[model samples]
Target: MNNTSTTTLTMKREFNVKPEKVFDAWLNPVTMKKWFFTLEGTNKVAQNDPKVGGSWEIVDHRQGVDYRAIGDYVEINSPEKIVFTFKMPQFSELEDTITVELKELGQGSEMTFTQLIHAENEEQWTDADIVKALDEMRDGTEHGWNLMFMGLKELVETGKVSYQG
Candidate 1:
């Protein structure tokens, strides 16, 4: 999600790998954690269930506060597209959609991540406390995504995943 209010962030990353493998990484828990984060440099995959009513859990042992994103699959097309509703009510945004699309490119694939983020702060203009909370959440969430994606790229390319997700 974009921090610039109402708008969402659209990041496209091209990988020199097969579409099936790339797509599998997204659906397979082990694969997902390897390239799940949009930015990179993050780890800990408790449960990355890809089916409907599945979860994208993480390890809280690395930090003082535990965080998790639970979601249900809205749509799934193997090696092509995936749509899911992600929610972390207490820690971050709720009712967000994470969609990933894979397209073959020459001898590689292009993985596009599109997120629709709702600025919870946009609706709480009158509440200073809520705005403050939302601000911090947005910053933290984006950083997390960044680190996750970076880590994912490294893991996938190296074929050395620390966890199966």
Candidate 2:
């Protein structure tokens, strides 16, 4: 049986950089490692093959466990749009899709990111636990993405990458 309930999260940010630069940061392994897994522990592996049908993977060592995130690119429209299927081994039952659109804004760029997440079974869990898990997931996702964007912005606008998060 599969859970029919889904969650969609959307976020937008404006960067003082060109769309190409912003887009490159997402696919380039060196730049991506600077921001990709900021929420969890250190990233043990980061690799990306930025093309339609190509795959990407990241492994993060958190505490004593290794969490692996794998994804396949579904669409790549240059500096304008990207779509991918994302999966995390820690949440093996759920499969998610992420879509990112970048629009040129004067001399800068604005990016819109949307993620659709299908949650796993919750039958054996209490309502409060489910709610709490959802809340934590939302907050953690938001925080992680924000930090990544900040890292992107800093790298693009100032040519510096800080791993403070």
Candidate 3:
């Protein structure tokens, strides 16, 4: 067995927002902050450029601690695909990259996300372990995306950019 634990995980949700708008939520910080956090109490500190070779990092401070994921965009196909690396202490032994793809579903959009996770060895590749990991990642991703979509739909439909709070 290989040391790399690459499970091509995917999830799809048809959102009530245009593919371009959904895509912009990812590229823009104002849109990203509304949904990207693991919890609402956390403060999201982010600076990113939504293009290939550009930086994308978010630091979430909650309670008295900080969690961060910093990486560079490997590629970007506007309103279609986004690929970048990921790392964190709270997530996993994450020396990997996650690629997010958006497909226009009629007037809305569907998102497909894949994460290439790195593990120490095959001993940690049990079905139970991997399933648990995938589940955590999947649920978190879907939840975050849902929040983002809702926030984005509100913004796009209302033509509001700045946060009231």
Candidate 4:
């Protein structure tokens, strides 16, 4: 039996930076380390090849726990859009597709980020339990992404990266 379920999370943010800069930051290892993964004692290894069929991996090590995110580039349109597959090795049951679209504003940019999360082997979850779990996951994911985006904005605006928590 194959049981799969999906949920999508979407977010939009405006940045006082050019679309190119914002797009490049997502693929740059140095910039990604500063904003994307800011956990203390977490060592990040980011390797990104932004092209169709190319792959990217980011490994964060904290307290002897390694959280690995591996993905492949499905589509890339410079300064405008990117689509990729995302997976966390530690949670093999969860897989997702992420897309980022950038629109040029007056002198800045607006980014729309979307993630479609797919879970396998979810047949065991009751309908009510699944709904609750997804709600909690969405809340937690939003909070985390908001913090990361804050760091990204700081880095792009002030050339400094600081995470409040």
Candidate 5:
């Protein structure tokens, strides 16, 4: 039998937009290409099938490397919640589940992004290398998500993704 544990990470953000708008941005291919996993000058290709059991993919071509993020929808409650499986095959074999919950607050929306990261193959819990790698992976995932959120904010609020003061 394999023994593994899951580490959960949750992040919250407030956006100056309606819950519907915020939720739709996640499934809209055009909007996703503009912000999701995209760098300033990189080309992004996004394809989203926004239904339960539907699959989605976003590929960012940057620095001559194509980084792909692909996933399948688990649950999608319009303007409320979304759950999907996330994976980046080139980087790691680890597949994680991400849940995004959105609620209307006043005239805007508040989003809670939760990610469940599963521990890899049967490794000793006391292994330093395993601990270190997990820590690094957690940190990197957080940083990447933050960057995407910033881009989302810029695009949803301004209809464009150029850096602003």
Candidate 6:
């Protein structure tokens, strides 16, 4: 059985860089290693194929375990928009879709990120339990994305990343 409910999380940020620069940072492996789904002191395996239908994987090798994130690109529009599906096989089977939209704002750019988090087995969980789980997931996901954005901002503005997990 499949539960089709989804919760959408939206976040927005402004960067002191052009849309093209900010957009490219997302797909570039070198830049991605500095921020995207990474933590301090972790060896990164970041690979990207920035095209519609292309797939990406980033594995962070920690002390005793490796955290792997895999995704496939659903849409891509240079300096404007990107849509992709995100999943962590080590965590759960639920896959989420994320959309990143960028627009020029004066001398810089603004990015709007939206994520559709799919609900888990509704049949096995109570409404309160589901709500709590979703709330936690939203909070954690937002924090992770915010950290990534901080790194991205630093990278685009200073050509370096200083944000540590």
Q: Cα lDDT of all candidates, in order?
A: 0.64, 0.80, 0.67, 0.81, 0.83, 0.86
Tens-digit lDDT string for candidate 3 (1-165): 445444554556566677788677777877565545433346467678877889877787766778887777898999899888877757665567778798877877787877665554356468777777666655665565566545555665565534322
Rank by TM-score, descending?
6, 4, 5, 2, 1, 3
Best by lDDT: 6
| Model 1 lowest lDDT segment of ten | 37-46
Model 6 steric clash pairs: none
Residues 1-165, candidate 1, lDDT per residue (tens digit)?
Answer: 223344355678877777787777667766554455321235445466666666565433233554555677877888899888777667565477888888999988888887776665544355665556656656666776766666555565677545433
For candidate 6, what is the TM-score?
A: 0.91
After superposition, the stretches of candidate 4 with alpha carbons farther than 4 Å from their true spots are: 38-41, 120-124
Write down the TM-score of every candidate.
0.71, 0.85, 0.70, 0.89, 0.88, 0.91
Q: What is the C-alpha lDDT profile of model 4 across 65-136, one tens digit per residue?
A: 778888999999998999998888777755689999999999999999998877563667888767777777
Report the Cα lDDT for candidate 3: 0.67
Candidate 3 clashes between residue pairs 3 or more apart in a chain or in different chains: none
lDDT of 1 at 137: 58
Worst 10 residues of 2 by lDDT: 32-41
Every model: Cα RMSD to truth: 5.6, 2.8, 4.3, 2.1, 2.7, 1.8
The per-residue C-alpha lDDT of model 5 at residue 83 equals: 98
Which one wins by lDDT: 1 or 5? 5
